[model samples]
Every structure is written in structure tokens, then in C-alpha cells.
Target: MKYSPLLSELISALTCLPGVGNKSAQRMAFSLLERNRDGALKLSAVLHNAMEHIRHCERCRTFTEEPVCEICRHPQRNESGLLCIVESPQDVLAIEQTSSYQGMYFVLMGHLSPIDGVGPADIGLDELEARLKKEPVEEVILATNPTVEGEATAHYISQLCDSMNISATRIAHGVPVGGELEYIDGNTLTHAFSGRRKL
Candidate 1:
């Protein structure tokens, strides 16, 4: 009638994933056990390995096995004085999928949310400032989502850039109001990046 403690624990752990309720977890556990044990084992192993080995890139803050992520390491990528700031690594992927942006990226890791106690420093603002000073970026593009928090974050960064005499810009209107960068289509993202306006 009841699963073993180990099996139950596995199901419970699976439920920790976003949108995975008890029913979904139960379904997944049963499917993993019944259909593909080897695949499940491989998945677990990969998860463990990634968790252990992956780290934030020193320059961009994207997760990678190396000290710097592939994007940061790529010699062909436009290291030619362009930086795109985003909210997360997923946003990096979304923009990359467009294949339009050749510039380097800076991941904020999170947006500024005072109510939730998330501040600029909490999301690596100091590092961003330091990087702007050290790196020769001609343009800094704010590619944060079109949400309230995202706008606020972008505004804060833009002001900082102004104070520091850095050329800062915000992506144009392709991204819907209150929409997330992760959910926007590649074409839209490309358009937004291409049509960026000075902040």
C-alpha cells in the first residue's frame, strides 16, 4: 500500500522542482522506475556531477565547469567594447538563441527587490561596477525583463553608468510589458537587442 522509505524520499525530493506536485512526483517516480532505470541513473549522476563541478563564470556569472563560461572564453565573440546585462543565465541562453548578439554578457543573477530584501549588492552590482571600470565596454545594454523589478534594476544600473560616464542603453519594445526575457521568442529578442535605445 505504501512505498519504501527510500522510494518515498525520492518522490518527495522530486517534488521540490518547480510545478512538480505530489501527483507529478509520484508519476515521475513510477515512470523512472518502470520505463528507464538506466536513464534515471544517468540523470541522477549528471545532476550530482553538475552540482559539484559547475560554477559561476568570473566575468559573466553564467554557470560553467571552467573558471569562465564558453561565451566569455570565445575569442570570436565581440569582446569589442559591448556588454549586455541580463537577469539570469537563462536570459543569456534566450538571447544567444537569437544568434544576433555578438557582444559579451553580464548576468545580474537576480533583480533588485527591496520588499523581498534583494538589493543591488545581493545581485553583484559591485562586481558590475568594477567590471565596467576595468573592461573597455563602449556600450552597456540593459536586457533585463520588462517587469517592474526588471525596469527598476535597469534604471538603477543606467543611473550608475551615467554617473560613471559609461554609455548605457535599454533594449527596445519587442519584449512585452511585464514579460520575462526567458519567455520571449528568439526573433523578438534579436529585434530588441538590435533596436536598443539609449537610456
Candidate 2:
């Protein structure tokens, strides 16, 4: 079916979003036009505003309207000389949801993918090293994803921390709380076994 120029343009723009295909874009377009026009308008306004105003926080690389993000500015979030390094703002959000971490953070935004031309500088490692030198950082937490690139990034960061004499630790990855042994993969099982602790 041929869409009007405006509809066709909307569908094309929507496909720019990750995982949004032509069909999904069409469904979204129709849903907004037929059932949620007001929501669509509000979303457009917010998207435009965010695109214009959102920037990476100088302190942690998280998206923020100000120079420093709320997490970096919160008085209760005093660093205590510990910093958690993650691959993206989403990882920071996931860790924050656990209410477990109590220190500061460094968002890499991307993993180390040499084949893709992403390197230490591309992911803000130099900046992180500078911060570590300036601050009395006692520990560096490697919280990057459990992918090959994530592992490489974590290893590089760990080496940097070692050279600086700061202890580096990695977040444990293993079977989920409700996961069963039968369904577990070999890599996860190995990690779970290697990271096991005594009762």
C-alpha cells in the first residue's frame, strides 16, 4: 500500500530507531494517528527538546541537561574513592536499581571493539585515568557487559588501574536466581563455578 508523503516520511524516520522495522513503524504510525494522537504530539515535543538539550555529563558521561548529572551532584552519593565503570547509561541504571552500589561511576558509552575502530580514547579511558589520578580512588569496578568487547574493555581498565596501584574488580556474571542447570550455558556455568563462594 502506498502511504501519503507525510506518512511515508514518518515511517522512514521511525525505522531509524534500533529494532524498528517497516512493519513496526507502520503499526506505530497508525497507532499514534488513530488512538494516541495527543501522546504522539507530546512524544514529538519531548524528542525534539531532548535532542536539542541533552548532553553527556562531564563527570560520568550519562545524558543530562546540566554539566553534571543528578547522580554526580547528589550529596549522598559521595564517591568514597570508588568508581564503577560501565559500557552505557543503561548499565548504570540497572546497577542503580539494585541499590547495592554506593560509589561514583564512569560510563564508557561503548565497548572496546578494535575491529570497529573503537579504542581507549573512544570510550573515555584517558579521562577515567585522569580522574583516578586526581582522586584518591581505592577501587575500580569493572561493570561492563559480559560480551567479548566488554571483557576486553574491562581488561584494559584493569591494567590501567594496576599501573596506578588501584585495585580493580569485576562484577560477577552467572546463572540468574531462578535459572536451572539444565538450561544454563557452558560459559555461564563456568563463571558461576569459578566465582563460587563458601557458605
Compute each candidate's TM-score over C-alphas: 0.85, 0.93
Clashes of each: 0, 0
Worst 10 residues of 1 by lDDT: 73-82
* TM-score (C-alpha, index-matched) for candidate 1: 0.85
Whole-model alpha-carbon lDDT for candidate 1:
0.91
Ten-residue stretch with the least lDDT total in model 2: 73-82
Q: Write the per-residue lDDT of candidate 2 for residues 36-134, one digit (tens) a residue.
A: 999999999999999999999998988889999988887656547779999889989899999998899999999999999998999998999888888
